[model samples]
Target: MPNGQGGYQPIFILSEGTRRQRGHEAQESNIQAAKTIGEAVRSTLGPRGMDKMLVDSLGDVIITNDGATIMDEMDIEHPAAKMIAEVAKTQEDEVGDGTTTAVVLAAKLLEEAGELLDQSIHPTVIASGYGMAAAKAQEFLNDMAVSISIDDEEQLKQVAKTAMTGKKVEANVPVLAGLAVKAVKQVAEETEEGYEVDLDNISIEKQVGEGVDNTFMVTGIILDKERVHPGMPKSVENAKIALINAAMEVKETESDSEIRVSSPEELQKFLDQEENEFREMVAKIKEIGANVVICQKGIDDMAQHFLSKEGIFAIRRAKKSDMKKLARATGGKIITDIEDMTIDDLGKAGLVEERKISGENMIFVEECENPKAVSVLVRGGTEHIVEEAKRSFEDAVSVVAKSIESGKIVAGGGATEVELSMKISDYADSIGGKEALAVRAFANAVESIARSLAENAGLDTIDTIVELRAKHEEDGAVYGLDAHDGEVKDMMSEGVVEPLLVKTQAVSSGSEAAVMVLRIDDVIASKGNEVGEGGGPEGMPGGMY
Candidate 1:
C-alpha cells in the first residue's frame, strides 16, 4: 500500500482481500444501482405502457400501471434503488402522474453521464454542465408554453385529453373530457377569490354489490333494512330521530332488598314484573311519537319488536359520529333512557339513497346544506383495482383543482425541467467553474426523472433519449427548449423539439433493469446489527449506496 503521505501506491503491497475501495467506485456503484432499478420498469413507460401484476408472498395480487405502486410493492433491497423509489414517490405525491416519467428520465441521464465518463468527461463536470443547460432549457420551455385565458375551457380540455389518451377510460374520452372540464369549472367557481382548481378532487372509485347505480340523497342513516330478528322494524317514517351513544334499554337494576325465592310461585312473580316493566317502557316511547331511532349500539330484540309494531323506523348499529350528524341534521335529541322516549321526541325520517354508474357504486348523502360537500361513497370491484382507481381519480381531481387554482397546468413529468437542463448544458463549456458542474448536475437530475419514468413504465431510456435528442436536432429544438416563433422556425429548419415519453416507458422492465445494472459501481451497507440485516459487514450489507 502507498503511504498516506505520498507517491504511487503499489497494488501488490496492499491486501487485495480487504473490502475498502475508492470513493469513485462507490459513486459508480450508486449510479449503477439507480440505473438498474430504473430499467426494471422501463417497458411500461408512456401512454402505451404495460401493466405489472404484483403477487405478494401471501398470494395477494395487485395489477396496476402506476409506477409508484409497482415500485413500492417490489421487494427492493438496494439503497440506490430505494433512492430512485423516493424520487418516484416524490413525483407521485407532488404531481400524481409522473412517477414513471421521473424514473425513466433519471436513468437516461445516468446512462448518458456514464458514457460521458467513458469519454474522459468527469462526472462532476458533466453534472455541472447539465445543470446550466437545464436552467436555460426550463426558461425556454416556459417561454414556449402557450398561456390561455381563464375562460379557455377548450385549451384546458386539450391538456386533460393529452393526459387521458390511451388510459383505461379512453373509450369514454368524450364523456370524461366533458366531465373533466365541468369538474374544473365547478371547483373554480366554488373556490374563494383567486382560488385555483385542484385536480386531486376529481377521483373515481368503483364498487361491487348492487353497485352505486341507484345513488340518491340521504338525509338520514342507510341501515333501513331490518336486523335479523322479528323484533326489528320493517320501516319508519315521519318520526323523531334520537341518537344514542349507549344502549337503549335500561341496565340490569339490582333489587334494593333481596327477596327469598324459595318457591316456584315467587320466581314466576319476579319474571312477570320484569316483563311488565319492559312493556311499559315501550308504551312510553310510542306515546312520545319517537317512531324513528338511530342507535350507536345494538338494540334488544324486545325493544326492536315493540318499535316495529308501533310503525317506528329504527336503525341500530349507527356510527357514533354519524348518529350525531343525523341528530344535528334533523334537530333531534339523543336519549339514553328507554323510559325517556316519547312520541314528541321522535323526528321525521330523513331520505337516503344509493346508486351505481359506469361500473362503479356510489353512495350520496344530502345531509349538508351545501350539496357540493356531500360525501360520495365510491366503491370498487376489487381492493387493488379500487385502490388504483381511487388513486387515479385523486390525481385527476388534484390536477383539475390545481389547474383551476393556478389557471393552468405546468408542463409536468419534468419535461419542462429536462428541456431547461439540456439548454443550460449547451453553453456549459463557455462558463468555467463549479457553476458549470452544478448546471450539468441539475440537468442530469431533470433528465434522470424522465429516464426513471421510462424505466418504471418499461421503455428503452437510451433509445428514447436518443430519439428525443434527434427530434430536437431535426427540428433545431431541444427536449426542454422552447423558442419564440422565429426561434421555432429556425429549430424547424434545424429539427429539434420532439415529444419523447410515449416511446420511453414502452419497452420492458428487464431492459430497464439491464440499463440500471450497467450503471452500478459502489455498494454501501448499513452499520446497525438489526435482525433482518442481510449478513454482511457494517455499512456494506445489501445493494444500497
Candidate 2:
C-alpha cells in the first residue's frame, strides 16, 4: 500500500483481534440475536405451551416451561440476547409472572423496527415512537384493572390457578392453588396502601416418596429435623418453645487460655464447674417454662442429657433462616443468651411433634394460634415431579401475593394484550408523523403476545389474531383467545386473570429492551481472550476497557 509519497502507514485504534460493527450491520446483528432468543422460548407461553428440557454440561437436567427458567438456563453468548433475557428476569423479579410475554414482545418490537429500518426510517424516530406507545400502554393497563382483595378468595384462587396452569400440575391445581391463596392470606397484613405480603414468610419445603395428593400446608413453621437426644420426648403438647441462637455448651474464654492442673483435685474441680455450667443452661430453659428448645447452635452432650431429663424436646443446629421463620411463626423473640430468656419469651404451639416421612424424621410445629410464617410441604412421587410442582406452587404463591398487594388484576389469556394494542393503536393515530409509524409498530409488537399465546395453543396464529381483532372491534376489548375452546371469549368471565403488575412490567421492560437495541448504531466486541500460561485471559494483561 502506498500514499501520495509512495509510502503508507495505518494506525491501530483497537486491539489486534477486536471486532467492530457499524450502522445497519450492527443493528441487524443485535436484532437477530434478540429475535433468536425470543423464538427460542416463544412456544412456551400459555397453559397449552410446550416445555423445554435444558441439560447443562454436567448432564443435570431441567424440564420446565417457565420462561424465566428457560432464559436463565440458556448459555447465551450474544450481548443483545443477554439484554433480552434480562427483560424476562426483570419481569419475574418484579411480578413473578408474564416472563414469556415480556421477551416475546421485545422480539416483536425489534422485528417491527427492522422493517421500518428497511424503509429508511431513522432509528431515533422508531425509538421515540416506542417510548410513547409504552407509556400509553401503561395508561391503558390501569383502565383495565379490577380490584382484588383478601376476602375475594375465589378470585385469588383463580389467579393462582392461572399461574399454575401451564406447569405440569393440572390435577393438583385445586389443592395447590388453595394453599397458595391461604399462605398469602395468612402472611398478608393490612397496610396504609393495602395488603402487604412478604413472600419470605411463606416457606415451601419439598419432600419425595409421597403422592402429590398428600401435599399439605402447615399453619406453623416446619423443621426438617428431629429431637437431639433419643431420651427426649418425641412430641410436646401445649408446647412452650424458646428460640435460641446461642450454643448450650459452656462458654469458652474469648482468647485461648489453659489451666495448668497440678493435681487430680484441681482437674476434678474443673470438671464439676463445667458440669454446673451445663446444668445452669438447661435449668434456665426449663425454669423459663419452655418445653421445646430450638437451638441454632450446637447443644452440648451434657446439656442434651439435662434437657432430655427435664422432658424438654430440643432441636440442635437449626438454620438461621429457619430460626427467623420460627420467630415469625411462633410470635416469639429469638434470644442470643440463655440468661436473657424469660417466661414471656416462650412461643406457644398446640403441639410440637416429630414425624417420620420417607424414612426420615422431620419435626412438625403446628397449631399455632395465628402464625405469621407458614409452610407448604410439597410431596410428590419423584424428584423431578416434586421439583416441578414446587416451582409451580411458588409461582402461584407469588401471583397471589402480588395480586393482594396491588389489589388489582386484569384478564389473562392474551385479552389484556389485545386490548392494549387496540388502545395504543388509536393513540398512535392521533399523532400522525414519522414517529407514529414507530408507535403503530409498538402496538403490533404488543399484539405479538396474543399471537404467541395462540400459536403455542396449537391454534392458527393469523386466524386467532383476526378473530381477536374482530372481537375487539365489535365486542368489548376483553375478548381474547380461549385456547381450550379455540374461540375468542371474555377472559375476565372465564376466570383467566393475571395481576395488573405483571402486564405493566412486561410492557415497560419489553419496550425498554427494544429501544436499547435500536439506539445502538455501533458495536465493538473484544475477541474471546486466549488462555495464557498463568491461567488468566491472555489479552487482558492490562485492564480491559
The prediction achieving the highest TM-score against the true structure is 2
TM-score of 2: 0.94
TM-scores of all candidate predictions against the true structure: 0.59, 0.94
Q: Between which residue pairs do clashes occur in model 2?
A: none
lDDT tens per residue, model 2, 1-545: 57689788787899988767789887887787777788888988898889989898899999999999888888766677778999999998888888988999998999999999999999999999999889888888998899987899999999999998988888999999999999999999898888889898988999998787788998898889999999999999999999999988878899999879999999999999999999988888888799999999999999999999999999999999998988888888899988888988888888999999898899999998889999999998988889889989988999999999999999988888888888888998899889999989988888888888888888899999988888888867778778877888888898989999989999899999999988998777787733221112343211111
Candidate 2 stretches greater than 4 Å from native: 1-8, 529-545
Q: How many backbone clashes does candidate 2 have?
A: 0
The deviation in Å at residue 526 for candidate 1 is 4.8
Model 1 over residues 1-545: C-alpha lDDT tens digits? 55778777756533444343244565555566566666666656545556778888899898777777878887766555676677677666655555666676656666566666666665556654554454455455556453444576665555554454434544434444455555556434444566654332332323433322222223333332343244544433344555556665545657665568999998999877766665776677666656555677777776776666766556667666555545544556677776655544444443432334444332232343322211223334446645554444444444444455544333433344445546656656567875565455445655565554444445566765565555555542323222111111222212221222221221122123323433444343334422122312234444432
The per-residue C-alpha lDDT of model 1 at residue 198 equals 38
lDDT of 2: 0.87
Model 1 residue 247 CA deviation in Å? 6.1
Global lDDT scores for all candidate models: 0.50, 0.87
